[model samples]
Target: MKQVCLAILTALLALTVVSPASAQYIWLDKNNVKVYSDKAPPPDIPNNRVLKGPRGYKAKNIEVKYTDGTEPPAPEAKAASAPGTPKPPMTTAEKNAEFNKRRMEQAEKEKKAAQEEKNRQAKAENCERARAYHRALQTGQRISRTNASGGKDYMGDEERARETSKVEETLRECN
Candidate 1:
C-alpha cells in the first residue's frame, strides 16, 4: 500500500511539471469545428483563425533544452541598487494644488446639475402653455395676440388653424 501511494505521488508530480509546457493550441478546421492539440496546426490553416492557448503558471527559473544539442545563451543579470534612497515627500503647494483641482471638478458638476434642472423646468412650463392653447382652440374661444406694433388683433380662421397646428406640434415635441 505504501509503494502504491508513493507511485501515485510521483505520477502527480510528473504531470504538474509537464502540463504547463504542454498548453493546448486551438483552431477551427475547414468544417468550422474547433480542434485542440499541443502541436501547431498544418501550414494550410490561416494564422488569423489560430487561437492562443491559456497561460500556465511558470517557475521563477525554468530551463529549456534544445533538441539540436546546442547550449542556450546565458541570461543577463540586473545590477542591484542601494536600498537607502527613498522617494521625496509631496510639498504643501502640491497638496493645495490637488485640493483645488478636486474642488473645481465638484463645482463644475454642481453647475451642470443646476443647468439641467433649469432646462427641465423650462420644458415643463412650455409644455403646459402648449396644452392650454390646444384646449382653448378646441373650445372655440376667442384667440388674440399682440402684433409687433403693440395692437391687439383677433386671430382669423386661417390664423387660428395655423396656431392650432403649431400648438399641436409643440405638444407632440414636449410630450
Candidate 2:
C-alpha cells in the first residue's frame, strides 16, 4: 500500500514538472523600481526584460521620460555695434570661399589619416619580419639583414644589425 501511494505521488509530480504553467519576468519601472510578473510586463515599465520562453520571445523596449531640475541660461542678444566699428554681413563670395577652404581642410585631414594608417601597416610588417628573423636565429639558422651586393640601402648596416640583435634579445627573454 505504501509503495503504491509513493508511485502515484511521483507520477503526479513528474506531470507537473514536465511543462511550465506560466512565464515570469522582472523589470524596472519609471521610478527605477523592480517589478515581477508572470505575463508581459506593462508598457509603462521603464526598462525591457528577458523572460524564459519556448523558442521565441519578443523584446520589450521601454523608454522613460526623466528630468533633473537643472536648466541652461537663455542666450543674451548681441549689443549693437558702435558707430565707427560697424559689423559687416557675410557676402556670397566670402561664404563660398570659406566653404571651399573648409572642404579642403577636411580632405587634407582625411589624407593624413590614410597616410598614418599606411605607416602603421608598414611598421606591423617590419615587426613580423623581426619575429621571423628572431625565430630563424633561435633555431640555429644564420639570417643576415640582406646580401652585401644589395648596395647601400636606406637602413644602414649598423642600424639593421642593432635591430636584429634587439629582436633576438626580445625573443630569448620574452619567450
Candidate 3:
C-alpha cells in the first residue's frame, strides 16, 4: 500500500511540471495590440480579448493572423555584396592572429627602448670617467707606479704625452 501511494504522488508531481510547458495564452494590450505569452493575461485585460493559444504551440516561426485580416510585414533581407569582388568577413582565428601580431610588435618596441636607455646610461658613465682623467692629467702631479719587480718607475714626458692622448681619445669617443 505504501509503494502504491508513493507512485501516485510521483505521477501527480510530474503532471504539474509538464502541463505548463504545453500551455500558452494570447491577449490584447491597452492599445488593442495582440500579445502572446506562456502565462495567463492580467485582470485588466477583457475576457473577450483573452484567448487560449494553439495546443503544444512553440512560439518560434509562428505567425499571428489578426482578427481584422491584416498580416504583419515580412522581415527585411541582408544587404547584397558586389558581384565577383565580394570579400567574406574575417574569422575568429584570423582576428586572433592579427591581435597577437600587434601585441608582439608592441613588445619588441618596448624591448628596443629599454636597450637604448641602457646604452645611454653607459655612455654617460664613460664620459664622466674621461673628464675626470683629463682633469687629473692637467694637475701636473708627479705620477709614478710600482713596477712588477718592486721598483718605482716615474712617467717620462713621452709616456705622459701617450697617456694624455689616450684619455683625450676616450673623452671624444664617449662624449
Candidate 4:
C-alpha cells in the first residue's frame, strides 16, 4: 500500500512539471517600468515592446526603451530593468568593436578640424605677404634685383608695370 501511494504521488508531480506559455503578460509601461500580470498590458505599449507572451501570444521582437517617452533630451534616459532580472545579451567582443568604432570617428573629426585651422592660417599669411608687396610697389622707390650675370638690374618701365599688375592681382585674391 505504501509503494502504491508513492508511485501515484510521483505521477502527479511529473504531470504538473510543465506549464504552457500562456495565462501571463509581461510588458513595459509608458514610464518604462516592467509590469507582469494575467491581464493585457496598456494599449500604448507596442506589441514588439512586450517582454513576455500571454494567452498563446508572442511578440515578434523585444525592444528595450532607452529614453523617456518619445521626447528627447537626447540619450539622457536609460533603460530600466527589474532588479535580479537577466540583462540584455551582448558579447564582450561586440562591445569592444563598438567602442573602437566611436573612437576612430572622433579622431577623424579632430583631424579634419585641425586641417581646416592649418589651411586658414596659411591663407592669412599669404594675404599679409600680398599686402606688403602691394605697399612696397606703391612706394615709388627704384626696385632692383640681381641679374643672371650677377649685376644689379634696375627696374624698367615695362617690367615695373608687369610686376604692379601681378601684385594687384594677388591683393585682389587675398582680400
Query: Looking at model 3, how many pairs of residues clash?
Result: 0
**Best model number under lDDT:** 1
**Model 3: how far residue 9 lies from native, Å:** 55
**TM, every model:** 0.46, 0.37, 0.45, 0.49
Which regions in candidate 1 have their CA more than 4 angstroms from the true location? Answer: 1-89, 147-151
Rank the candidate models, highest TM-score first: 4, 1, 3, 2
Residue pairs that clash (backbone atoms under 3 angstroms), model 4: none
Evaluation by TM-score, superior candidate among 1 and 3: 1
What lDDT score is found at residue 13 in candidate 4? 82
How would you encode candidate 3's per-residue C-alpha lDDT over 94-164 as one tens digit per residue?
Answer: 99999999999999999999999999999999889889878877788778889999999988878888999
Tens digits of per-residue lDDT for model 2 on 9-43? Answer: 99999988864654456665444456666676666
Number of the candidate with higher TM-score, 3 or 4:
4
Predicted candidate 4 versus true structure: per-residue lDDT over 1-175, tens digit per residue: 9999999999988777644434478887655578877777666567866888755774444344656576433222333433444456569998999999999999999999999999999989998987887787788788899999999999987887888899888878876
Off by over 4 Å in 4: 1-90
- Residues 1-79 of candidate 1 have per-residue lDDT tens digits of 9999999999999999998776477876655668888776666566655776546522133456899999766532211
